[model samples]
Target: MLDVLPIFSGDDRITRLFTLVPGSDFEADALSAIDALGGHTVPWSEACDGTYDLVVAASPKGDLSQLRGPHVLLPHGAGFNKSIPHEGSADSASGLDPAYLRRIGHDDTPIALHALAHPHQVARLAATDPPAARHAKVIGDLTLERVLTSAPLRDRYRASLGTGARKLLALVSTWGPESLIQQHPGLPAQLAAQLAHDEYQLALVVHPNERSLLGTYELTERLAPALDAGMILPDSHEEWASVLIAADALITDHGSAALYYCAAQDRPIVSVHRGGGELIPDSPMAVLLGRIPQLGRAEDVAETLRAYRPGAGHAAAQAAFAPPGDAVDRLRTEIYALLGLTPPAHDVAARPLPLPAPAMRVPAAFDVHVETTAAGFRITRHPAGKALPGHHLAVEHGAADEQLARSAGLLYRRPLPASAAPVDLAWTADGWTRHALSAYPGCRSAAALLPSGECLLRVRGHERMYAVQTEPRPERGQVVRIDPAVALSAVHARLLSPQPAPESRTMLNCLIGERTFRIVLRPATDTEATHVI
Candidate 1:
């Protein structure tokens, strides 16, 4: 309905009424989704008897005959390929369900013109319900076109997702017992464990049906590991399309989202569970999956991800959509024709998808990975929930992960600015002069970075924590900033010798990944370590 909304541009020209056709579990989310778009909705129970020129709905649920008008039934999802229970008794091809179409009349005619995405669907309907097929027409796919047309705005979408430098690898799962999350609940967390947190951003793309069924609390619990590892979870259906455009690659199961990915774009893919799902035997989704590079749950996830290159054979899925680029104009014409009115404009087009604002969580604790480079220390981090081998653990004070805090090798609290992502424990710092190492008795060393980009460290036995800043103080904004958590990792490495801390006025080069900070270590004077920055 939003696609052809432009044709009915004048407010006084057409009175647009929206209502929920409640049936599936997903209807619970429909109201909020409509609210987000600022669309006024009438209660489905109350709006049932109202007469209208035409009713544009995506589903065949409820008594559509109540509208007292012609209808245009759009495919609710990327052209339905999965079989579903129909009318509570029998199994039927999802979109081409004969029972649903026959609900309108005795001769197998549907209440609305069955708008399909491809010719294959028309053929599928012809084979099953020939009477309904006669009313069906290929109107191309609006969602697919939106995903493809928004290609130029990938950078904007990626920026909104905060995916800097890292390629976004989305875990696209459809809803069902055979879905990826149901089959491999640990995959997202485990995959995040495999990839460097600094090098990649992992996202979990869940269908509305699945989200509605699992509930946020339960789904968050199941994918906690991945969430702990900083996996993104998008809230609305529109955001999913933007994420698809922004995504560099995908790790998917046999859902329509994956099929759409294959049709709309040629990005790299890693398929999970090749033999699962109640897919239509010769459906485009089934044919493509029977041959994509497979990722067994027991196999090394990182290796599988790196091995699956883009441009693998997905011809079957690519052929799923017909006349895709012309969906907007074609859709407008189709909708207006039902109203018996000429379209306002012949070349009506859809805009790029809205920017995605994913639910992002910053992991406070990390198993800090360090290497002694010639310049100084090179640091990388993994979420402490599932640390890799040989990682030196660092947990912030009062972190949600208590076990990590107790077992951490280095613990510190730094005074952080607003809108900052903590490195070590930069988010918490009450004071500096009154600060004592005894506060973190479980760790060997405690450290902090001041608001002015100064590094401070306190060895366990030291009377005063050292104030380490570059001489003449560092300049106000350098491209590669320092995280006290990362700086402390380098400092910990330097203090491993008899010198438990950097000597006064001694210049040291500290490197954390691409960021290099030059600092002067000094034992804080009585007046210097007495006040907080």
Candidate 2:
């Protein structure tokens, strides 16, 4: 039997690619739809141990050099197209680090199976990186294929969102500091307010990174007006896909969401500018954006929505990336060829797998147990204990010296246990911390007590854990207590610095027992204050 491991990092789009192939085991960033796909989930480190027949990754960042077997590069989206400015230009090529390009380029690269979206991408890779071109095979867009083939699923999704008898418009959000929503924070509500509720419904599908950076409460608050206006928020990739299919028109920033939606549904799209007036020069997103109607101001969104036309630039976008709906079959054939196995008979009648539940913020990798005690809480790790043949353990957080057991579970005791002492925690704009914490004796979990008296518990690699305050007061330099409870494992906080350095900045004032701990906030020098959050 062929052992294939689909490795997914933080990108949820990569997870969608897994839905195209059933029965393939996955090593994802967390417990995700992969679990529903009937494959056991393993850590990326374990998956990279090179035991599988093949490893498939969406991004080029992972350490594939250690792989004992061949690995494939399944891009997260369509590759850069000709319309993308400077993509094939020698000037752009000259600007890139040759060493970095060589590492990711075709020649002497680790990628054994590189899947391209179209012939244009293949040709570009050949000219830019010949080795990559030699290994490249055009598989088109798998996500678009899922959208095109799964009509019944789309109907169910629309019904689930209660979007009936109403023209739906999807406002898709992307990550990055200067994303569309970031550029226009009130765009969703502004647009929703302009449209007549009886005629059209609005839905917001935010990129996962936005939630990570802003925290759930802040993001919810930012979009509160829209949600109150009956704008549907589809939290999972499956739901988002359905929203795209159900939407008559799409409003997006400079992200692949617009491109994917347009290519798959052939719907009209309204692109919003990112950062300054200029889009990312020579990018596919910029190229696609140029072809469609755009809105620079929130006030103009209403007019754009009313005048939008479906099938605008759909044929050209489809030709550039989404070639045919047989991408899944083509990918399977490639996988079989790579593994030296015969392709299974195609099942034309097989309906696409039902979309799994929306992905959760904290992936279900290990069972996290929180035991509240007088001194604080005891956080323990209980492995699923399933027999994952040829798998290992890799922890994304915590002390580097701390060892992960391949078979045994870990017990995190409060008060700093000598065996697992010296836990380090770092906070950033992104919700999750960099390292995991191993409980020691007297080592209680730290929390950021919101001004509303609601406690936000700390999870090692998550930023979405928080109790909603009935009345929220969002302000700058508002002193909030930081509580250290035994029940909490890690404290997740987002620090927003919109201006340059002052001498002293107070992040949060924590009141624990009789003492108060003042946390200091500082940003790296020379970077813009806006860049911090």
- Which prediction has the highest lDDT against the true structure? 1
TM-score of 1: 0.80
- Residue 272 error, candidate 1, Å: 1.7
lDDT, each prediction:
0.69, 0.49
- For model 2, the stretches where C-alpha displacement exceeds 4 angstroms are 1-39, 81-101, 104-110, 152-156, 274-283, 309-311, 346-533
Candidate 1 on 148-213: residue-level lDDT in tens? 788788889887988855679888888888888888887887777877666678888898888888
TM-score of each: 0.80, 0.55
Instruction: List model 2 lDDT by residue over 1-533, tens digit each.
Output: 01122212232322322212222223231245456556555554554443555656554433445444566776664434212233333333221212323444333335677776777667766776676567788877766666667755665665565554456888887655557667778887776555544345678777766665676678877877666556777754456777787777788876566776776666567877643432435556656666677787766765776566655647446545846667766776677677676644434221352543321221112333433334332333322221121111222223222433222122221222224437744232222211213342221222333233333333333333322121222335443233222112222212211232223332433223222333333322222211111
After best superposition, candidate 2 residue 307: deviation in angstroms?
Answer: 3.6
Worst lDDT run of 10 residues, candidate 1, spans 425-434
Q: After superposition, how far is residue 189 of candidate 1 from its true place, in Å?
A: 3.2
